[model samples]
Target: MSGIYIHVPFCLSKCYYCAFYSMPSLKRKDEYLESLRQEMVARKDYLHGMPVSTVYFGGGTPSLLTPEELKTILNLLHDHFPVEADAELTLEANPDTLSLEYLEALNAMGFNRLSIGIQSFFDDDLRYLGRRHDSRHARQCIDWARSAGFDNLSLDLIYGLPTSTADQWNRNLDLFFATGAPHLSAYALTLEPNSILTKRIAMGKAQPVEETAAVRDYGILCQRAAKEGFVHYEISNFCRPGFRSKHNSSYWFQTPYLGLGPAAHSFDGKERRWNAETLDGIRSEYEALTPENAYNEYVMLRLRTMWGLDLKYIRREMGDAFADHCERQAAPLVAQGRLSRTREFLYLTDPQMLFADGIAAALFY
Candidate 1:
């Protein structure tokens, strides 16, 4: 299914580990809105007349946008794109910005999913992450969303702090499951080179994330999620039956999607493009993928999900040479007990999923 992604690039504050582009103030909201509309009009055909099944409003705290502002963008999308009648509309929210009235307005405007960032249900953890919301606000955010008639809820959590303990991570999971939210997107804290968190480490002001801590937390996440009856559909995502994020699935499934706003990315069957701000104005940069690049991506993305890599599809679409290469590459891992396979598919073993990226890289064309 085709999808549309809108990056709301305004945030009240920048988190230490965040690398996504965002303005720390909303002073340019009007300019951003206008530019976003221009982008929608210019790239309306990116999906090639496909019916859009999902629309996701992500980052710099999309919840910062007023409901009226969000409605305007959604209306424009419907006017220019063939939005499906039952499209899954999702918005990423910071718990500090949600209220009963605000959530009710969002629900009224057809936002069926709310992805709230409630990273950890501990005040100390929130402080360490530089989150503005306390555990109390997070609890209140969930209550308000439910009171406003939202049932398709997703919560974001981060584990693998440099100082993380098993008890702390377990507490976070316990609190999360108690909320009864249908979806959880849990990630190990990653400190990119340019991120503030990494910079702090370079300057000796902060400690970097520990690999041992991350591995331990990920194991806990997988085991607990399984016992909780949540499916591990993606590397960092878990959901109750029928609660997967369709918009996000479009990325791994290699479906076409149009991305709007500065720093957003768009992909068609053959090309991938993204926007950036320049001295002149926002402009696009893109590359036409080579066969090898496409093949590498196909392997990388497919293995991130529980569905694994389809050998049949590889043989049918990418030819026998590529399929043979896959077979040769997978043989060792399969024997090592890191991967298991059927005649038609190959998958990572549960204990080895955190090594998925490294494994995918090894299979690259």
Candidate 2:
């Protein structure tokens, strides 16, 4: 029910669409790893000794770490934290960075899950995303992972690329499903400010994202995933039965989790704390959780997932009056086909989930 997340904030190169806190230099790897060790010691009590069921090594590309370096970090976590025996330990891998040997080392170190970043099967789309791996490496990495005995595998794919046609996207999905990857985290590309893609769009060098096209592609993806027997458990995640991500499902279920390293966020069913953007600054802001902080966090995070806001949880955490106010405000949207409710839970319907943020804000207490 509880989780630990470690953000490995180093990448070989920056992707054009990436806005996450990451540095493309390995110059400070030793220093950063030492700092992370110190962070583990400093924030050991953040989860209050909850048995950590999940430990995710998310990017800037966790596979970039050498096996020895990764072992040191994992050893430190096991030494300091209450990581469960069957923890779903996940490492985000870039296709070019994973090899049979590296994956074997990872398996030996108890990393059971691999979320491989293979954004597209097409070489052109890979180039557009500024990905380091070619399409061949992407295909090869999945085979190597299976050969290394990784069953809990997920592949991250992207659609709605300016260079992608409907046929091309379908072909990409065809190849992806053919690999027998049990889980898929496919996303529609977004152009955000300060990203190279955004800058290119602003300067007329790249075509603007066709919103209609993106939505159409999303619908197509959802339909195809359903036909392939993958559950659309979360907005962007699809998985074969029993293959849903435990860590992400914990987030939606409002379970407690601690996030380590730079730009990671933590929640403990109440309060939320996020590490700083820069590595040094992350160390400095390790201990700042308050009661009022928890309430605002419950609202923001709970509203982001398919679970939405449960009045019972709000009444128990907040107050009955606040819960009533939320429901009263949500009534209009529910009637307008943007929201849906059972007697126990209130949430956005499938069509309305695309506007979840705006709907949540409209009914915010």
Candidate 3:
């Protein structure tokens, strides 16, 4: 149930909406790779020899790494950790970088899952987002992945673009489902501070995102995904049965995980830790999870998914007073149809998912 997350911080160019730490040039690739290996060796015992159930290489673009470099890293992990024989190893990829040959090699190297960042299958949206690949390239990449024998594939899509219309979003979803990928991670386009999109909006060069439009699009997505028989397992993720992301689910269930590389966070049941955002400060930042903090996170994380919170478990683990507080807070939401409860669990209604964070915060002790 535990996981490992490796953050690869290199990309060919910056996307307009990206706020993640990444360097544009691979001029320092060797240095970074060496540093990554060193970090892995140093943190080898962090999991206490727990059998890693999942290994996720998320990035700037993990596919940018050569097969040999990837092999070396995986070899190091195998050498140092008790990685499960059938671990769900995933690599986040950009379409432009994936070829049949490269994908075949990746499959041979133990990457069973591919999370391709397509963003949108529209050329206009791709250009607006500053993505390197076009619509055709994305389709070709999926074809190549299937040809290379990858069945557990995930596609990343961004909806709620300022110029996105309902028809356009539907077309995106239609094309996405046609690809037969088992998992989809659709996200709303947010204007994060200091991002290129945010700056453009500030300069009056780009229109600000319409909150109402985004909500409407989210509704469209939910309805469409349900019709397609995809499970809305998490607020932003839809997957076919038995295809939920094991690594991400570990986070929701509060299983211990060790995160490697800059800007990565980790939890070990009681304490939470994170590495610094910059390579120069790759050391750890530690915080002990107090009873209050843990209770807040337990509710927050559980509320983000379809699994919801187990009230009985909370009463047993977090005490009856906390459980009673939750019931009192939830009674109004349930009455208003924003929340729903069964004998054992409570969860947000689909429409209320957009307000999950706020609702969780409001219910916090």
Give the number of the best model, judged by TM-score: 3
* TM-score of candidate 1 relative to the true fold: 0.97
Can you write out model 2's per-residue Cα lDDT over 1-365, one digit (the tens) per residue? 58999989999889989998899988888888988998899889888888989999998989989999999998899999888999999999999788899999999989999999999999999888889999999999999999998999999998889888888888999999999999999887998788988987788877777877677778778789889998877778889998889998887676888888888888866566788888664543434445444444555566656676777887887777777877788788878877788887777645455556677677765
Across 165-237, the per-residue lDDT of candidate 3 in tens digits comes to 9999999999999999999999889878889988888889878788888798899999999999999988899
- Between candidates 1 and 2, the one scoring higher on TM-score is 1
Q: lDDT of all predictions, in order shown?
A: 0.90, 0.84, 0.90
Residue pairs with clashing backbones, model 2 = none
Q: Could you tell me which residue pairs clash in candidate 1?
A: none
What range of 10 consecutive residues in model 3 has the weakest lDDT sum? 275-284
Model 1 error, position 321 (Å): 0.8
The TM-score values for the models, in the order shown, are 0.97, 0.93, 0.98
Q: How many clashing pairs per prediction, in order?
A: 0, 0, 0
